[model samples]
Target: MDSSFKGILYPTRLPSFGRFPAPPQVHHLVSWFWIPEWDIAPGRSSRQHLIAFAACNLVVQHDGVELSGPTTRASHQDLSGKGWAVGALLRPAAVPSFTSRPADLRDGRLMIDAPDLLAHVVEVMGKETTARGAEAAAVFAAWLLERVPQVGQEALLANAMAESISNNPDLVRIADVAQQLSVSTRTLQRLAVKYVGLSPSALIRRRRLQEAANQVRTHPGLELAALATQFGYADQAHLANDFQRFLGFTPSSYQKSLTAPL
Candidate 1:
């Protein structure tokens, strides 16, 4: 498991998962490229759980490409055979090229018709002796640059908004993100809806929740009440409520699961 597993809930269950930084050419369009290659034996399965980042993903599998919209809650995928997938964690600036109404595709996915892009990635990944991480990511980034050659000013602003909310823990409120980005709250809300498929407030909560969960997993001895205060939750109960609502478990339960024997 990697130290930067912020969104992943159970690192022990993952297969050969790798996340590569996107090249500078596609920085405005992609956050990073993630690849997962798996081979499971007969009658076995690996289920990966995630409190996914509140953004879209462009995924390429052997079959086809698909555009995944923002998720409103926890999600999981069960892998049960030999397979590989190349995925780009798309930035807000890249969303419009794929969908007009991001909000409509919340917690959903749209199959895309990017045969050329899919073929290139698949071909790069199929080379047995080549190091697939950087090469595959480069191919994916190149395709993105070709597809979305230019980013508009408003789209860049949306990217900034998403980055601000995601990176700043002190930004617990929508107004904080708006002020930090020099935009009005209404404008922030509109940008979030158009680009992120969730409200600004939802983005804030997701980051907080992801951070809190990461802390709980990393520091099992930390007190819940103190953790809540540190993450801007009103109290321990509020933090527990968030964990229950989104992750389907209380903080203590999640902590205990981490130590449970296999």
Candidate 2:
């Protein structure tokens, strides 16, 4: 553990895909880490699994494009961010001309990737803490500060997209809001694609899927047809198709086994 970073154990593991078959266990866990200055983490080392990282400052040095849908280890590196999903709203940096969409920005943080940024963070944090506790957290924060920009318009747009999803997870239409903003639907789509790393529709669908799954888990008795219709699916088949693609489990099986013990 590293003392430079304050580590707090999160209660559940994040949602992800790595193993061919989904793991039987799922817990929501997050590590809150802090780094006062710039630091760097090496790029991912060809490993399985996705990790999520958040920070106030981030930069990029590779070919990252904002893409929607399942991102692989080799490709997930395309999207990145520097702040909380909610906090990016108050920032000023413009959207990245390029980025990696939907992948964990803080996953696989390594010091060798950006040395100058790492130098900046170590200078801010004052000392190393791997001698004590929170080593991963400290190094991770430093790594983010080294890579992500502290402020950007992309952050704001991402925040907006997030807020939009939160308000109505099932409804996402670029035309509705973009025209309201006096921007073309194309412009909004571009913004979401470039800065937020999701098409407006994709973000909406992602949020809806999350909400739908939660409903399924919490209300196992609900009919799939009803749930699917409520969430904007054409019918049960549409819902089932999406559920399998995103979660790796059929909705019925996922619900049936929910109480079998993780």
Candidate 3:
């Protein structure tokens, strides 16, 4: 289970959210499964903000399923009524099963025609049990396993590229990632476009920004310039520019907002 709120911007305002690791059988296909259940008062709304991971997600809700592509900026969802969503943070190896032109679907989503999958997950979620999250993730993993039984070598390489860029903060440049993965820079770019929708540089930037924001929120007294140095930004101004561009607020403002009265 992943309890850390890595990409979520406002953990304090979230509803019931759970993130479970993918089963070993489907580990190559799915990074993890996340579920967010929300119930708001009448005439009020709870807005959830995020700088989503630089990867696609297959989300299953009450109505149907959706394949959400990678994002380039901050985004939010307003929940006004009772609802829940079971989402799979798909790995690069599994993206082709859902969409081939992932680059075209950047910052967008496509409706998936998977009624049986939706029904099965919904049934498991409706069950009265304490392990709804784990059970629902298991069923989701089972469905994915049935759909994508075998992963190709190139697809596995793409997954390796994504994992390298995401998990290694030292990989601040496309060349660094390419060298780490022992692939040419051109090959890395092609893999990212075909599987991740975002460029390798974009993925690195998103990871840095997310880490910087998390630090700002958790370590309110930390100097922005020091954070920038730690994250490989040129300076404090660069970090502030990233925050303003992606999150629409400077680091100081964000930190102040965190401690502000509601």
Candidate 4:
């Protein structure tokens, strides 16, 4: 852990973690890869709280592999002992390649057994937990390439919609996104729910709150009213409500916690 670091609800940078982009071949299905290696001191553990994006993840630990779905609210994980994890951040729409119903796993997780699409990747990640940097990424990418052929067109479109949502900060309404994509609002909602495991409005809200959290962290003294207006919130209260709903903390309190000493 960074000694100077204080409490932060959404940690963009972790102390002993590494994230790498996926290779071109599987880029559409896989967003990025992450590895976290940690050795918590005796009688000590670390907990990280996060507002998970509208996406799924394939995580490999020493015990076995697990498929984690998108979370609707805040989630956390406790890190203890000497442990490590190799994780694949799957594109929201690409969830079908691994599971039939993305929404079924929302705010929940499932175990990966043999005879599934992820078995081979699980096998490889089992052996590569100690591999670092590009070596671990390469091993994961090679496995993903074999399964790329299974990704369908709906997943591709869903991934593109997710990209659009995350990239456009000014997007406030699902109707606006539907207009931009030349689709009806109902169609867009169906696609999002089916592929991304979230409604378009939910996705927009998640992205906006994420931006707000980053702004609060980077500029601790920034005015909440101004930040709220800048990010399309109706008012500071609206923003604070979202922060409380999704992050379990108000923006001001979150900033205060971050600035406080460890």
Candidate 5:
């Protein structure tokens, strides 16, 4: 697909952080030491162009950190070489690692802000991980931003449909999306069915469930009851049941997985 908006699309540089050399077995889809506390602003960092947004980063901090989402924190000493981060293929609504609030990144997208539009580009990043080696990270970033997906029309429509699912998973209807985007329900439905390989409703549901998988694990303060509410569940039981279907783990199990040692 024409992965323009999904892969690396811009030039990138390192922010004035530490000067550590690249790690061994270092794949390029992730840049070097995107160190926290560099004081980047709300907009994309100057070095943002260097990162392959479509790719995932499994970051392990040099120093330990107690990160409860963006702002919730604890004091860890020098978090230098802890290379653990999980990168997403989608442009998220939340501020990056350092900041809190979704508005920190772009307009601060809602939880389901990232649809599957970046999937193709994410795949490309996986392929380039070794071939391009260290350059893969930077190169992938440029690819994602330079153009729309190869199936440009299909991808955009599909992405919109997916976004619809994220807004309100259970109660979403084409009429709701029509109202939100200011288009007729029929128009949105037609575009989604024609290009996305699924009806708009189907796509939306899928996005909502997939997004909840990751989100359920993100908030430490959110116990079962609270997390269920955030994701629109009637109660903890309902949320756990859905969670098992989508993620194969109950909500509590999911949280435990994150804290479990390797």
Candidate 6:
């Protein structure tokens, strides 16, 4: 991805962070990959805030591996001393294949202590947590190929629905997705909650808010009314309500914060 689009959902922090594409075989299951390395000064710590997206993640920390479910709101990650992590941002539809139920994992982190989960990844990463980015990525891909199990037709269909919801900014209602997929709204809702860790409406709202924040960050001067209409909010006031509810700031306030002196 381009630098302009890299930090679309996050505030600028962590001077040493890079995003990489997943390997071809895993592209459908994974959206993109990221590695974050941070060094903090003594007696000082930093916390990075990320406006969450509608996806699960595999976070490989120095100590262990964590499976994070889709978040309904923003997240804050603390950093101290020196450390690095490899994160595989799973597609919204891919969550069920790796875990039992997405709803069980929502708003939570599952510690994957199973040796089966990390044995291949640890071997591939070698004993060095500070490996080069390219080498680490290759290892991660190999681990993915060897460890991440294959998904089924249901997962593939969910992936299509999720991709549609994510790629289409105008998607406002769960009914829209149901109609697109030729399924009933109830079916869509069930699938979303069971496999995506969110209700269908909640997923749609999350994606809309994500796009809104991205636009706010990438185009500070964009008109809120125009943005609301573009992204299917009923009006500017509706957009403001969502921005405040999920992002803890109104659209204009967010824009000003982006432009304020550092």
What are the clash counts of all predictions, listed in order? Answer: 0, 44, 0, 0, 35, 0
Provide TM-scores for the models: 0.97, 0.49, 0.97, 0.88, 0.40, 0.87
Per-residue accuracy of model 4 over 1-262 as CA lDDT, tens digit each: 1212222354643547777888888788787887777888889888877766668898877677788988888778888888778788888655776787878988989987634434544455456545545566777777667655666676677787888887887678887888877778898888888877778888898878777777777777899999999998889999999989877879889888876765
Lowest-scoring 10 consecutive residues by lDDT in candidate 6?
1-10
Q: Once superposed on the true structure, which residue ranges of model 5 sit more than 4 Å away at CA?
A: 1-171
**How many pairs of residues collide in model 5?**
35
Clashing pairs in 3: none
- The runs of at least 3 residues in candidate 2 whose Cα sits more than 4 Å from the true structure, single-residue gaps closed, are 1-155
lDDT per prediction? Answer: 0.91, 0.40, 0.91, 0.75, 0.38, 0.75
Tens digit of per-residue lDDT, candidate 3, span 1-262: 1328988888989978999999999999999999999889999999888989999999999999999999989999999888899999999999999999999888899999999899999999898787998999999999999999999999999999988877888899999998988999999999999988988889899989888888887787998889989999889998999999988888888889888875
User: How does candidate 4 fare on TM-score?
Assistant: 0.88
Q: Each candidate's root-mean-square deviation in Å?
A: 1.4, 11.9, 1.4, 4.0, 16.5, 2.8
| Candidate 3 Cα errors over 4 Å, as ranges | 1-3
Mind giving the per-residue lDDT tens digits that candidate 1 earns over 1-262?
A: 2336889988877888889998888999999999888999989998898999999999999999999999988889999989999999999999999999999999999999999988888898889854876798998898889899998999999999999988888898888888898889999999999999999989998998899989998888999999999998889999999999988899999899999986
For candidate 5, lDDT tens digit of each residue in 151-246?
344444444544555445554466777777667878777655443323565544444444444454344556678666766667889877765663
Which 10 successive residues of model 5 have the least lDDT summed?
Answer: 66-75
Clashing pairs in 6: none
